[model samples]
Target: MNLFRAASLVSFLTLLSRITGLVREQMVAAMFGASAVTDAFNVAFRLPNLLRRLFAEGAFSQAFIPLFAATRARDGDAATRDLLDAVASVLVAVLLAVSILGVVFAPVLLWLMASGLQAEDQALWMTRVMFPYILLMSLVALAAGVLNTWKKFVVPAATPVLLNLSMIACAALLAPWFRRHGIEPIYAMAVGVMIGGVLQLAVQLPALWRLGMVPRLHLTPGGLRRSWHHPGVRHVLRQMAPAILGVSVAQISLLINTQLASHVGPGAVSWLTYADRLMEFPTALLGVALGVVLLPQLSAARAKNELGQYSQLLDWGLRLVLLFSLPCAVALLLFGEPLVAVLYHYGAFRPVDVAETVVSLQGYGVGLLGLVAIKVLAPGFYAQQNLRTPVKIAVAVLVLTQLLNIYTVPRFGQAGLALSIGIAALCNAGLLLTGLLRGGLYQPQPGWGLLVLRIVIAALLLAGALYWMQHHWSWLTLPKGQRVAIVSGCLAASVGLYFAALALLGLPWWRMLRRAAL
Candidate 1:
């Protein structure tokens, strides 16, 4: 499949997963509210999620995919199968060790991540209950990387839907019974997470079997060790170490937010979590979709020393990201409160919670553009096996984020945490783009500058129009029916205004769409 088509397929599936995830989160907020249980659950979920990214998604996949792709290119299917089995064997063993350690030391881990919480025991309980998820998910991630190499984006992207579905089912059907039996609903959610991970891994097995890529169980360390000596594997590892650090740097900003939120009043973590969920909707659907689809293509092109193709893919990816991301960012900034209120204002999630969460959501919205750009740009380095550059930049941004947090959190509370991360994302994006240019892997074509200028202008126009509508009209403040109408109207108007601006500025939306469609 072509880059655009691949990205579209990933994006569509991702959108479905994200929407379902939003529903699952809404259920959690309604049932748990922004209290100790919610905070504990949030921290618990984040801990495993952090590791999943660190080992599986961030470092492992970065290392695995390029070499896997290269092996496919040079050798035949058997070579690829052997490499996969070797990697899978090592992956399962390593993750099992890690999961066991996590189960044994859940309290210490929770204490470190959320030190400010007074309810340390509560936190530890949730962590212990949820930590097993990391093991299941890491395996899922390994399977996902294998699938992505086979150009099977659907199953991997769709796997997240199982997670959301599991959580939603548990919350809707099982939570009440658990509560009646004097059990905490959070435990039920924890169980749901473990089940979700199993389902996620299971869903991919059929696809692997179909491709004749099913990994065989092998306990021998030599097979995996051979990967270290292979040139492609060495190159991937070299790229992954820095990419891991780079991704970790970005994650530190989030870690700071989580820590700072813990220090704030009750419900702070939930509020931040809710805001993040909303922001992630667009980022996951657009940014992640592009990143996943672009990396293998870019990696293969770079392996063949095809700089022109790599550069073109980067260009196309950036344009497509901007095309969708810029408008979504604008919409979030404009209607953040209304969106938050609509999705999560029912049951235990009171109006006050909505108000607080929306503040953080809006702060996140302000940095949405930078966040999306960082997602689209960082893959370029990883594709070229140049992970260290992004890592250094990420560490710098991490320090900056913490410094900002130290200064801002005392003054602005949880919202300040969001603001600090947003600023850090902007800095991170600038550094990534600068690194790309300095490395001579990415440079603007003649129309590139003009295209960006037009996008900015269109965004500005849409923002102005939304601002006026928000201030001059009371539509957003209306009841449910009218509120939906008003939000929908604002969305339509903003979209129309942006497209009009694009056309007026001589941007080729139709041509881009046609190309993407083809």
Candidate 2:
């Protein structure tokens, strides 16, 4: 398989998801601004997301995919199908119980997540409404894992676009309808979220069905018990034990940060969230795209005992990480205010909000390389079924993050929170890379020094260009269309300049495609 081609497919689809996602956020910020109700929605929405990461994408995917790949390799289609059924049965039962508990404990969850929220009742109501989204997303994650293992990457990659479109529709249309009906307009966002979840899950089914990999869910008490005892199910649970610890450490950090942001002020959470939406564009386009493509491939290589292939994959992914993420980090740090102004300076969103969000965006940009690098590095341990190492590293990073927050938050406010996370990410990525090298799991390829030099030179040129563009425009004072036009032109020019500089510096631009042919 061409890894570059696969990663490119995921990246292109993810770009669509991120574009629609920005439009969704733009609508939300325009209609609501960084108000109390928007904070409520951010807090309420995070409830299921925290759990979804823990249960579905985080621990579950880390544990399930490697084992699933290995099982399919060692056994046959029949055995793999039975394993899927067993896993799906247990997963469904667990999700149902959790969703119910979440709804019943909505108030407690909201308070725990954001006790300082001014609109507690509104948050509680939205929390209850959106809590069950975890159920839908978990199933979607399951289908994604299956489809990805089969190298059917398109459907899962495209699934997020549906959610983004759903929210975009709700924010544009449903929000106004709610206002007319004397209902809270922000409540429509929660409704849109659930709608999106359903659509996301619905699309995954047909994809799975086409591959004949649809899991036959068993809900009966006897059937559930039998599934719980299945060997494959037990194996997955065992893997998840450490995987959960690893994932929980990261989620717990987010939980703490959310709690902290709530205390900062009304718009604090929204500011950080808006900045996160922008950060996620490049992170998803490059980092997530590579991670999704690499994990299954790494697992397959490991299962076959192809040690050389495993290391080569890591090397390729890391090089791509440095080559692409450097220019993005530079752009985010240097050009954030203009990006924020053009995308969000509308309706209720004010000039003040733009300034506040720019601080957080730059903080996030400070560690963009590390943040993206982790997406590639952690899978090195996960593909080897060594979840404990990353868990141990995460525990230390968690402590370090909070310590930084203690020093920074009181001094710099919510931007400090973002800065702490970014700094911690750099440390986390460094430790992971060190572990891989010391264990001889990865050997750096030759010419890395030259590669780094060329990338640095290219990034410097890109940074200079962005700095010039940022100063030349009075982005906040400009009309919307003019602002959009200039920002779009600057982005195009910046990308072109970065790649042209890399080419002139003797970097092999075609090597990414050519290496994949091997």
Candidate 3:
């Protein structure tokens, strides 16, 4: 398999999802603006989103994929298929119970997450309405694991576009209708979340069926009990134990940050969320794309006892993160205000909101490389079936993050929350890389020093150009059409200059498309 090709395919598909996601965010910002209601919505959505990450895509996938790949390698397709059924059965039963509890305790969860929410009733209602989203998304995650193991990356990568589109439609069509009917427009977004969740899972079924790998879930009580006792299920649960803690540490940081942001001000949660939307462009395009493509292949390599190939995979992923993410980090730091203004400043989205979001965007940029690096680095331990090491690193980082937050949050506000997370991510990534090297699990390839020098040089050039454009343009004062046009042109030029500089420096950037074969 061509790792570059697979990763590119996932990246391209993810680009579509992120683009539509930005559009969704733009609509939300235009209609809702940065207010207590928007904060309520953001906080409410985080409930299911948190659990989805903690259980589904985070610990579950981290545990399941490596084992799933190894099972296929050692026991063949028939055994793997049976393993899938057992896992799916157990996952479904748990999801059903969790969703019910979330709905029943929506108020308690919302208060715990964001006690400062002004629109508590709206948030509670929306939380109940959207909590089941975790059930659907968890199933989608299961399907994604199965499809990725089969090297079917497109559907899994593309399904998120459906979610984005659903929200766009709701914000466009349903929001106004709700206002006319004397209902809060924000509730439309909750309905969109559910619709999007259903569509996302619905789309995955066909892809799973095409591979003849659709899991036959056991829905009955007896069947669920039997599936829970399955050996493969037990092994996955064991793997998920430390994996869950690692993911939980990160989520706990987010929860604490959200609680902090809520108390800071009304718009803090929404501001951070809008900035997060912009940040996702680089993260999803590079970090997530590479992580998804690398994990299965890394596990396969480990299964065959190919230590060299495993090290090479990690090296390739890290080099790509540095090469691409540095330029993105530069853009975010130097060009964030213009980007935020151009993308989000419309209708109810005031100039002040643009300014607020830019701060968070730049704060996140401070660790874009590390944030992306962790996506690749953590998987090294996960693929080695060693989840505890990353968990320990994560727990320490969690403490460090809160300690930094004590000083930064008081001074920087929501941006301080963003900064703390960014610094902690850098610490986390550094420790993970060190762990990998100390264990001899990963050996750095030659030319890393030269690669870093080239990336730094090119990033500086990009930063200089972007800084000039940012100062020259009146992004906040310009008319909408002019702002969009100039920002688009400047972005194009910046990208061109970054690549041109790399080429002039003898970096061979195009060779990325030819590297990382599995």
Candidate 4:
């Protein structure tokens, strides 16, 4: 499949996953609300997720996918499997060691993430119980990278539904069981996480076996020695180390946000996580799904020395991301409160929680464009086998984000935490784009200025419409059924009106989007 078609398929699956994820979040919020227990679960879950993003999605994909694609294109299956086996062997060995240490020093990790919270021990205990999720998810990411390389997009894209289902089931079923036994339901949630991680890995294994590319674990020293010394494996290791440092710096800022929010008060961390999750709905749907589809295409383009196609592909990805991400961000800013209230206000969630969450959600919405840009831009560097540039930028972004937090947190509280991330994301995206242009690796297509203007105009109109509708209805005071019905109508109208505005401005996407199919 071409980039657009492949991306659309991935996006559709991701939309499904994100919808399920929202349901999962709704269940969790209803059960635990944004209290200390939920806050602890967020920290524990985030510890693994942070590493998963850094290693699985960041370092591993940056290093592994290009080489794997090239190997498959040139040397065929045997050679590709050799590279896969070698990488898998080393990955398992290292992640196992890290997981052991994480579990052993779980308190240290918690102390780092939640030192200011008076009940740090609660989150710390959960972190220990859930720490091994890192090991399970690392393998899952490796499997996903392999599947995407083979053009098996649907399975990898749909894998997260398993996680959402696992969490939802545990929250609904096992939470009560744990409560009956005088245990915090959060512990059941943690156990659900480990089980979900395992299920995610299991689903992908059969696909690999079918492709004749399932990696055989070789944990013995001789096995590790043989794998690590290969020239291809060594090159992968070299790229991965720098790439890890690059993404690790950005993740550090998030952990810092967690720590700072922990100090702010109860539910601050939960608030930040909730707001971030809502933002992820669009980021995952567009930027992330496109990133997943683009890398293999980019890698193949570079391998064939098709620089023009590479530039065109990058330009298309960026334009599409900006076109969709901007309006979505605006919608979040315009409708955050009602969205949060309808989705989460129940059981233990109070009015104040919704109000604070809306503030942070808007803050995060400001950086949505930047966050999406980085997904497409970073891969531009990675596919070219240049990891150092992003690492440098990431380090700078890390400092910038922390400095912003230092200034913002004292006055803004949870909103400050979210704002720091948004500002840093914008800065990071700008630097990445600058480096790409200066390096001459990505040449901007003509008509960018005009295209951007049309998007801006349409977004402004859409925002205005949404703002008017938000005030027109007292959404929160209505019955639950009425609230859902009105919100759905408003959302549909917002999207339809935005597209109509774009069409009126002579930027009809239906025709243009199909051209991107090639």
Candidate 5:
């Protein structure tokens, strides 16, 4: 697959997913507001979501994809199939045990994660309802990795659409039923989450099957033993062990922020979650999708011993991230209040909620480049089958992140939690870049100095225009339709000027794209 073409497809699909995600968040904000109930839901979701990252996104992908792609490239189809069967079967048994334990120990987990939660019992109950989502989502992650390695991006990318649609349907339909039955409606959201997980896993099955790579589970005793201990599985196991540490350390930072937010106030967790949902828009659309496409290609490049191509792909990723992400961060930093107001200042969501969300949104915006940069750079380490470097970096960043939160959270509340995340992201990107360059693993492309200058100049022009526009409009006072129209226009103007600045500065837009393809 053409790297940029594949990246564009993933980006478009992911953009749809994120848009649906925004609708889902808007539904949550409208129904529950930044209340203790929303706090309960956010805390409940974070634990399982963190685990999902560990098994599915973080450790597993970092470890699994490079190895899986290499197996496909060098070891042939039969061996690749054997690896999948072993990994999938063992993964099922492990996750089943872990999910059961999670449900049984929900309160303990909740206390560890958010001991300061004001509505501790409510959060605990919600945590139990959502703990099983980790099991479901982990399986979904494995299925997704398999499909991605096979270049079947459609099913895996489209699966999130089902998840978002499920959540939206449940929030709109089932929550009201639960409320009518005198049950807390968030319970319905938890149920929606489980259903979504099932669909996410199930929807990707046909894709795997078409590739003839679906691993069937053996239910009998001897069969189970055989599937768990394939010789090829040992390499995956070794890589995964260190990857778990890296994933855990990374999650520790988020958990620290969530825990700190709990201590700050009743609605702090909800505010942070809401702000984070918006902050994730660009990260999801550009950083994540680009990373997904780059991983298998990079792994393939490494298997072929193409170091020059490896450096070029890595450089391409960084260039695209900076080119797109910098302007996005600036836009969010400047227009965050209006953006928050337009999207979420409705129903149970009040002016104060918007104000709180805007603070955290801008905080997160500051780190957008770091977040996007990490998506590509960490893959540089992973693609070379070097997991230890990222583990060390993640550990160091986790420490620095919590320390910053210690000083910042008390001063800035939810915004501090958000800001600390940005600081940690920047630190991670810096460390990873340093390690890559110093290790002599990656070579920088030419024109980086000029590229950085162009992006900065364009982003500054966009920021200035946005700041000026902000003074001319009363975002809160305008009618909702008018507010959207005016903000949309401002966004259009800012985007145009950003590109125009880049062009007028003698950096033709196509030059960046052409360089990335090198």
Candidate 6:
């Protein structure tokens, strides 16, 4: 497929998954509120998710895909099949071992990540109940990498929808049972996660089967030992080690936030979780969609020594992210409270919960551009097999996060944690962009500066218009009206204002749209 077609497919599927996820989060907020149970669930869910990113999505894909692509290109179908079987064999054994360890030491792991939670036996119990999801999801990750290599982006991208669907079902149907029975609803959520992982893995099976790449059980090493000796695999490993570490730095920021939130108050962790869900809507829809679709194309181009195509593709990806993300960031900053109120204003979630969550969401929204930039740029380094730079930068950002957490948490509470993370993301993105420029891998195309200027102007105008509407409509004063009027109005005005400003600035929204169409 062409680059635009590939990106469109990925983006459309990701947008669907993100919308379902929003609905799921809304259900969660309504049922659980910003409470201790929600906090426990967040910690439990994060543990598996962090590992999923670190090993499954981040390191494994970075290391596996380039080699997989090479194998597909040079060695043909047999070689690819053998490689898949061998890798699958090793992966199952490794994931099983890790899962056993996690189940056995669930409490200890929870304590280390959220030390303050050690005092709360309830949190520990919920964590143990949810810990087995790590194994199921690791397997799912491997399957996803295999699918991505096959250029079957649709299934893997759509798999996340299963997770949200499962959670929503549990929250809407099963949560009441737990509540009436006096059992923690968090346990139900944990069970939903395990089921979600299973479904995620299962959904990809049909695609794999159609590709004739279904991996069979093989205790023997098969091509696995050869993969260890393959020069391409070795190169991938070399790049992946540092990339994994770098990715972990982002996860570390979340872990630290959770740990600190655990100490802040009863629902601080939940508040942060709620805010992050809002932030992730745009990040996943635009940033992750671009990164996942672009990386493989970039890697293939780099392999073929087509530096110009690689650079152009990266540039296009960045432009796409900026076009969508900047305006979304602006809207988030202006209407965070109204958005939070609309999504999470029911059940046990109250106006106070809305207030705290909005503060965190705005803090996070401030760094949304940087967060998306990191997603778009890191893949450039990974595609080039240079992971150490990102790792070093990540470590530096981690140190900054710690320092800020220490200084800010005492005064600003949950908002401080969010701000620290946002600042660190900006730092990481800046370093990545600098490195890309220094390596001469990125150059501004003609009119690039003018395009960026137009984007900035449009975003500012949209923000201003939203601000005016919110004040004149008294959006904050009318709680019920604020939910519908503020969110819908801000979104509508931002869309109109941004596009109108872009037109006024002579940026060809139509031409660009036509190019995307073509």
Better of 3 and 5 by TM-score: 3
Tens-digit lDDT track of model 6 for 429-500:
999989998998877567778888999988888888877765565434566754686578667767887888
Query: How many angstroms is residue 315 displaced in model 5 relative to the true structure, after the best TM-score fit?
Result: 0.8
Higher-lDDT candidate of 1 and 6: 1
Stretches of candidate 5 off by over 4 Å are 514-518
| Whole-model lDDT per candidate | 0.80, 0.93, 0.93, 0.86, 0.86, 0.78
Candidate 1 local accuracy as lDDT? Answer: 0.80
In the predicted model 1, the residue pairs found to clash are 34-267
The C-alpha RMSD of each candidate to the native structure, in angstroms, is 2.3, 1.0, 0.9, 1.3, 1.5, 2.5
lDDT of 5 by residue, 157-219 (tens): 878888889989999999999999998887778788878888888887888889998887764
Inter-residue clash pairs, candidate 3: none
Per-residue accuracy of model 1 over 1-518 as CA lDDT, tens digit each: 66677878988999899899999998998888888888888888899898888888888787788778767877878888877776777677777889889989987878777877766676677677778787788778878877887788899999999999998998898889988999776778878888898899899899989998888856557765664455554555566677777777766666767877888977898898999999998888788988888787777888889898777777777787778788888877776766876788767988889888878887788778788888789888877767778778888988998898888788878988888878888888888888888888986656777888989899889888877776665533468677777777777877888999999999987666433221
Model 2: pairs clashing at backbone N, Cα or C within 3 Å: none
lDDT of 3 by residue, 1-518 (tens): 69888999999999999999999999999999999999989999999999999999999999999999999988999999999999999999899999999999988888889998888989998999999999999999999999999999999999999998999999889999999999999999999999999999999988888878889989898998889999999999999999999999999999999999999988999999999999999999999999999999999999999999999999989989998999999999999989999899998999889898999998899988889999999999999999999999999999999999999998999999999889888999999999999999999988989888988999898988999999997888999899999999998999899999999999998886566555
lDDT of 1 at 391: 78
State the RMSD for candidate 2.
1.0
lDDT tens digits, residue span 1-518, model 4: 56778888999999988888888888888888888778888888888788877877778778888888878888888888888899999889988898899888888777787776665666777788788887888888888888988899988999888988898888889989988999877788888888888899999999989998889878899999998897788999899889989878877877888888888888998888788889998999889988998888888888889999899888988989878999999988999987998898887888888899999999899899999999899989888999999999999989888888888888899898888888888999999999999988899998889899999999999989989988888766778888888889989999999999999999967654553443
TM-score of 6: 0.93
Clashes of 1: 1
Q: Rank the candidates by lDDT, best first.
A: 3, 2, 5, 4, 1, 6
Write one digit per residue (lDDT tens) for candidate 2, span 1-518: 58898899999999999999999999999999999999999999999999999999999999999998888877878899999999999999999999999999898888889999999989999999999999999999989999999999999999999998998888888989999999999999999999999999999988888878999988899999999999999989999999999999999999999999999999999999999999998889989999999998889889999888899999999999998899999999999999999999999999899999999999899989999999999999999999999999999999999999999899888999999999999999999999999988899889899999999999998988999999998999998899989999999999999999989988886685534532
Q: What range of 10 consecutive residues in model 5 has the weakest lDDT sum?
A: 509-518
Error of 5 at 457 (Å): 1.0
